[model samples]
Target chain A: MSQKKSSEPTPLYFVGIDGGGTKCRAELYDTTGNLLGAGVAGAANIARNGDVARQSILDSVKAAIEHANLPPETLASTLACGGFAGANLPSASNALKQWQHPFHSFYFTSDLHTALYGAHDGANGAVLVIGTGSCAAALKDGELTQFGGHGFLLGDKGSGAWLGKQAVVHTLEAIDAIQPKGQLAEAVCDHYQAHSATALVDKLNQANPGVFGELCPIILELAHHAEPTAQALVKEGCEYLSAIARKAIQQSNGALVLAGGVAHALQPLLDSDVQAKLTSSTHGPEWGAIMLYQHGAFNQGANA
Target chain B: MSQKKSSEPTPLYFVGIDGGGTKCRAELYDTTGNLLGAGVAGAANIARNGDVARQSILDSVKAAIEHANLPPETLASTLACGGFAGANLPSASNALKQWQHPFHSFYFTSDLHTALYGAHDGANGAVLVIGTGSCAAALKDGELTQFGGHGFLLGDKGSGAWLGKQAVVHTLEAIDAIQPKGQLAEAVCDHYQAHSATALVDKLNQANPGVFGELCPIILELAHHAEPTAQALVKEGCEYLSAIARKAIQQSNGALVLAGGVAHALQPLLDSDVQAKLTSSTHGPEWGAIMLYQHGAFNQGANA
Candidate 1:
């Protein structure tokens, strides 16, 4: 018996969502993969904001669909993929999967998953993210390996948060007379208007990742000006990043792609060998989210 | 005033409270310096436990008062001094001061303050508390200066929690194939039954300072057994501790006294120079609390 071709919706269009601790971004594309529109919303880290994460994601996706001037029903027809913070955790991923989205097909993965995918274009390679939080991931064949990203408590070494935290620590030490005040320490004190150890500590106790991250550039600027303490912190941070990158490169035997706002500032401090092996990434994690469906990395489940 | 010597309280007895994160200990003594009794209760870190800290402290002190077999009215006659965790924080100390305790007088200070006083026996010196958390404090001419002990996030450098944290970090690295597993890592995995990197990360995220502190002795035992990784961690811990101790000693220009359960265990790991400068503590923080009255550190206010 010959099966006749039936009229079916084309699976040529896709939506990508990159969810972060600070904000979420969603983008839509057409059959030719031309840029359609993008939308931004608040934080979508499920571990941090819980149920709010779901709403942040929905808002971004809906805004993206509207901005593209597409029919609202198109959101239900298009394939959607997302990579979000804390998605690696079973509790987080399971909760996210239970969300009843209008998309024809939905896929979810960890932010690191799309990061490595976007950085290396689904090839065996390594991607280092050094934003407010840091993580190093390597994709070898299909298996993914991670070195850090243990959150602020256990790890996130060489991250913007780490740098800022170190700066604050040094400032406290200086205020306590344990260490001499340097340019970075002075700037930190000036930033918080903390002239004593007690005041500095009080300020630090109330600080979150965002507040700490704001000090990263100031510390890096001191490094650029050749301040000894700042140079030491930058050197130490780069060393940690280099070590993780080296391990990922060794594991994957592939290219290295660095991401995040702090990455460029830190790259100059990396060892010559690490710098030599670095490669540029053409797309962001949002693009990688869409690529996940296109490359079959994101499962279609019963929708297929 | 000399004519009104009839029917007055002697103000001869003293109560000393040494408050910690995991427990609050109280000791009672007479004017002759004879130990009357001691009692222990739950955590008393006001910054972490809030109202619970006050309850724990009261329970411990009440138990000690009872154990001392003193008259109920003695509590009102006794001079009391408390060295509590987070006492340096104005909010915590201020709240504590508002409590109406049955004491002739009350004094408040950070745990480090009492630790230093106890270790030095009221003399100007330096003390290093290397327990679940680590801190170094120097006392010179009635001035107390502290270094480290900014808690797990910012500092607490050469502490049980820090060592345990390092072991877990190395375990994660080994699990990820970033580093080879060592004896310490093996023990950590065995303890948590974590056979994979993901499991290790999950276990680490759920662990608190107390949980991490439980692992310190295991890591230190491995160090004593000459395990390379454990030795490395111990070496690093000693270096950090030594730096702080050195600065405190230099600042105070006095003898060094080591306190806390982890202190004696870690003494063997200290550099010969730091070890040479160490001196035996004549009294505990309870004694220091008593001495606060003798030294007139506690201000006498209306019973309110």
Candidate 2:
């Protein structure tokens, strides 16, 4: 008996997208749950990048599909889920949903949700993300509990941006003779090529989170070498992160993960009690996004 | 030999200007230095306000001259000095000097310098300025030492702005269920009309220092009622100010004054040790500007 190729909406392809203020990442997977390809593009934060967010997301998704050696038409049959920064805002999420996509079905979630999912391999656990920004979330039986993702203006207490702000403040104090100049403070002044407090202030007034975050590694390095100011900043940041971890733990099953670009740098600085509770994430956010496509609480909301 | 108006220059009048981020004030005085009249106008932080600073200064100076019943030409015969918010910055001071003021001579000094000078009547002492922003400075042997005036981003550790930021932070935490919602937090949410954490975050992300500072009074009022979150924020602010006061006292001759719009509100909240060191200001910043014209360190630097 001769048979034609099956074309009954098989959902053969799955796509997972992770979007943030700095960049967007997408991954493509096969029906066998095998990772096929991944791509990255510029920022996809709807509230910040505006209309460009849609283009960035689409570009990243197409890049991943092309990388996987799939026909362009396969994108129409893909089941997709995206966890994005600013997705918690209804206005931002609604605007994002307005963009046309060829996916068989799509679901949206906050980046914090994806991070928590990836950290524990879809299990009930907690995660603290301390990078350019800071936030903490816990998962309990498919429900999410969030804490302290209030952005740089209101909170992000132990974030890279917070540490950077502290470094700048200390550097300015040193220049003004309010504080003693240490190696770390001197390094910060040198980094900005600031010869005077005025110059430093002017430069810092115009700096964005990414530029500010560049100082984080410098400060952490100084902390490692025992510079007083850097040491103090690190201690303070760790304390705040510890507070976040404790709260997250209360909402979870006590499986905690510190996950972000800046997490490892801050790990050793945390107190012994907090250090003891941290576990390595089972999979990256891309895998978590793929899993979310298949079975995420967001799907229930979207379908309803 | 002044039978008629002499063409030769005469220091018949003195003018003093106190410039801040939000407003500028000018006072006119007779040759013997008695206050004649005062005028106030818009913002005058040259670094931040640009050319508008010059206009604000001119408006206040003209107003003061008019109030004093002096001819417009009297400005040319006046020995004028100003202590402005960004006077420490070379570009700002230089741009200020470029303005074609009619003063016989002009002097520039930092606002902190004026605050310290006015607080002690030009007698070596210290002042903690706790207004929309915070800074501490001490005067010793005509020299000034400053602390914690790095603006909201860098420092201003115990300012109204700092307190406001803390209030917003606590409000966000309450919304996320990480902390309990008290009256102060509820007030904040009501003030911003934020029904959700995301709304509050979005509003805060777009806020400027002035808008944020508006929340300070609300927090202070709530603290007065013994609201837990507001009380904690006020206590934290006081501790930082106390630390600043301690540093200022070290550089001073034990004479300390609490100055600025918010100083009185925070005065009673300080540690007893800090309160014990406090002294009343002999004059306001406008008088300090006039004293600066006669004997400020700025004169020595300018003449050099």
Candidate 3:
């Protein structure tokens, strides 16, 4: 068979970036199987930290281009897509416009949008992101229709941060001897390196929420070991996340796709309840970016 | 009228102190109604912060004696009573025993015991302390029973700290645009100098639980203006406190006396729903100490 040359220039490469509160990552690829480059940088969520997020996005994009050995001038000609933290808010959108990155076309959406697309391979479904913060998004026919992300104080529910907070609470209770003796008390003390409840308070008071949220993995480890307090925390988190999924399904009439770091950690908890309603995605946000580019979603003035 | 003179020297003096998580206060009185001295210091809750609490109690006691100009040599003949945090804990008992004051006789009890005695004039009743921490205690025919007081994280349902925490959570929800708009967001933001949800994250991350708990007064102040979020917080606190009261009543079968800074602040919130179940106390721990000394509870260790 003879190879046939297409008449039009191959669709220009498209990049999709998931700019989160803690980190920004960019994936570059063409329509074919060529994986150009991947870039990582500091946080890029304007809703989380304004100017820092914008700088992170710019830095990440530049790094990806350099890593791919692509001409810097050609960066402006490539279609770029990003799902950022504050893009859903007008104030954040205005801040993003101040960035002087050159691109042939660009599309910006909330982080939920890209995660949803990534989870469902551009199809219609729901995706729950549970990490330092938590949020759920439902897509119906390629359009986001419902969401449940706001952070810990509001509706984080089953997020790692939430579990970590619960662990701290339980540990403190044990230290006070207010609640009956439980394994969680010892586990928390061990995790924080505190000899007594008073010391634990000092440690917790000094630590940041992000640092505290990091302790969530220890909670999971304890849960696996059958600690009652740890089990209760995970159970509560799973229930909250499941409720979010149920609400999303009710709103969008779609299946559920779990994403983010905490997603796989909580799979065992979710599987026992919503196994039939869930599926894993074959392609992630990178493919979702290409799909958006092909549909002309990344036009010069599309976002405007 | 001539007074009968006895050869036995009258008891030189008696003192009673209420040392709590937020403050340490002591009252000194001679055999007559003459007030000798009064002293105040910072928090003295050994369970919450051991070294700070111990130092506060010692400082307050020293200040009282210094203010009264009592001869240091005569102090050994004085009778003293103290109600302190963690007095109920055996581990704390040993630590407390290390404190040696220049007094002939000394007695110690949990703050709750003194508060109950103060509120009920040494009679049997229940008193709920809803300060930075929440704990409920009931006295039934001289027997003390307690519940709650797990600290800010584990329990403390109706405490100032608990209400403050709830207010923060609601404010965060409002900032995230997850919950309905309310005055709580404005009040909290105004107090913390935070303009957005992300700013709140930083504030909460860096602030200590005590600092966070201080915001309770703000919430209480706003509730007076009929703000729904503020009102809700107070209402919830009242209900939780009442629930503890109800439990104490069921366990001890006694009248109720509510004490503590939070109880006074949220008094308006405790409407008939709470008042119908329990009676408020006219006095607090200070009076309780005097009554204990007068009744010779101090002379008999078992009675104390």
Candidate 4:
């Protein structure tokens, strides 16, 4: 279905959406720097699962517009910016283009770009994203250099996924006599409510990565409590992330910004080692989108 | 029952026993270096479980004597040496005094001491033990210095137990959406035969430390297959162990020896980084016991 309305300039309102594999969020703002609305929905990483991703994005955007108290027709002249997981894949990007929204302009980029923009306020710098997955990217003179994020199988070091995976390995080793019993094992059992190591095995085989990676917070909680094993795991993850940031800086010699859910959660992990190398972001991805829009670099329907 | 033996010098036999938590083994040797007999029995770590320690020791000695076809009354004098877990505890030495062996002289020491002697033949050196638990110790001028054996709760840095524990944490984190799916998670599931994270929880709770630690071999296997996560865990473990060894060397300024079941298994890990720092033990704990016996240390039964 296609929705259309007369174009009326629309007070230059713009929308920015960050869509990931597990959840999608959108923020809307006007030219005067006033936040119009924000919305959240289920996952929208099409490469992970197409139909779910499409539905999540549509729902998230619609919710934001509705929350702004604007009629669907009012979107006719509004520009939209989207940073979506899997948008780097041509097929996934094509799938996104199929959606028919009543908007005057739309621009799409990889979620990394928006996150970097959000972190750097559209400046030339580097951003390390440590959400469910991990990735590193650097921007210098408007060009981007990227590393890691080959997905869970190949890479994604220092991401929540990486930490979660390490924690589980420790747990299984403890159960199998290849490791020893410790606080991490106790915490895993307590958090998951599983009666034994065998039960955890069953769940691991049946669950998706998203479901498995969710247990990562329990580790963070344990680490905060000074659980040695958990603390060690987090420390190792930070080291990896810091190494990535260092490499990115060496390549681009730019400022650095950290983004993503886990990034904020693990801010303490950045410590002086990472902070000495880079600067923090002034605004997140949504604001980055606004900057792009203001700079006339984003054309709503041009690419589509 | 206490048995009296004739003053026939018991054919001047030397008995060396390695008393571990899992099993106890004793070997009898004559002056010419011929093995008279060998005996094996159950757990004999007196310091760990006091009630059974004495009985376990007696059973092992009886088995060895019986295997040697020695007449109980003809045994005039014998030297018996043993290395047992928890021997560092005073209770372990006290329990040894309760043993009513027909041997004229007996001695006991911590398993670590024997392992060091076995590995380096009483020479000044260091040893890294990564068995059910992990520890590092150095022997110099007949003095011992140790690091990283605060039990499974506090340390055991490079042990197999450490690797196994990391695996479980990763599996749970994957289930919880805190991490992404990768080789480590898959290996954990396969190793445990668990279908999902929920099942892993059950498995972890039902299994004990020994059982959970069994899965450590799987991580080692995965590391060989070039699983990044597994490799990282192993590398981390090795690094920690090496650090402990370095500290030991700094403290004692001695050569290094590697000992224990896990030590042999993790030789590749050690050789990768600290090849020149270590030399594999020419003998295991049994020989160390014999060396202690020859030195007449067993006769004093000194409580240290």
Number of the top-ranking candidate, with TM-score as the measure: 1
How far residue B85's Cα lies from its native spot in candidate 1, in Å, is 1.9
Per-residue lDDT of A29 in model 3: 70
lDDT of 4 by residue, A176-256 (tens): 434677888876766667645445543453344566567688888889999888889889888767766766676667777
- Tell me the spans in candidate 3 whose CA falls farther than 4 Å from its real position: A1-156, A159-304, B1-12, B31-33, B66-79, B100-106, B196-198, B206-209, B271-273, B277-283, B290-304
Candidate 4's docking class is: incorrect
Task: List candidate 4 stretches off by more than 4 Å.
Answer: A1-12, A31-33, A75-77, A98-105, A293-304, B1-304
Cα lDDT tens digits for candidate 3, A1-304: 0001224333366677888766788887765747788888987766556778767776777788888888777566566777876566555566666555566556677777777777777767887777776777788876675455655444466777778777876666555444566776776677778756545654564343465677778888988999887888899778767766766665667778777778889877873445567877756765665665556553222322
Error of 2 at A43 (Å): 5.6
Model 1 lDDT tens row, A62-106: 888899998787776777788887777665666766676667667
How badly does each model clash, as a count of residue pairs?
Answer: 0, 1, 0, 98
Residue pairs with backbone atoms closer than 3 Å in model 2 (clashes) = B76-B102
Candidate 4's error at A218, in angstroms? 2.3
**Cα lDDT for residue B90, model 4?**
48
The residue-by-residue lDDT of candidate 2 on B175-274, one tens digit each, is 7665788898888888888867888877777665656777888988988998887888889778878877878888886678987778999899898888
| Steric clash pairs (candidate 1) | none
Order candidates by DockQ, high to low: 2, 1, 3, 4
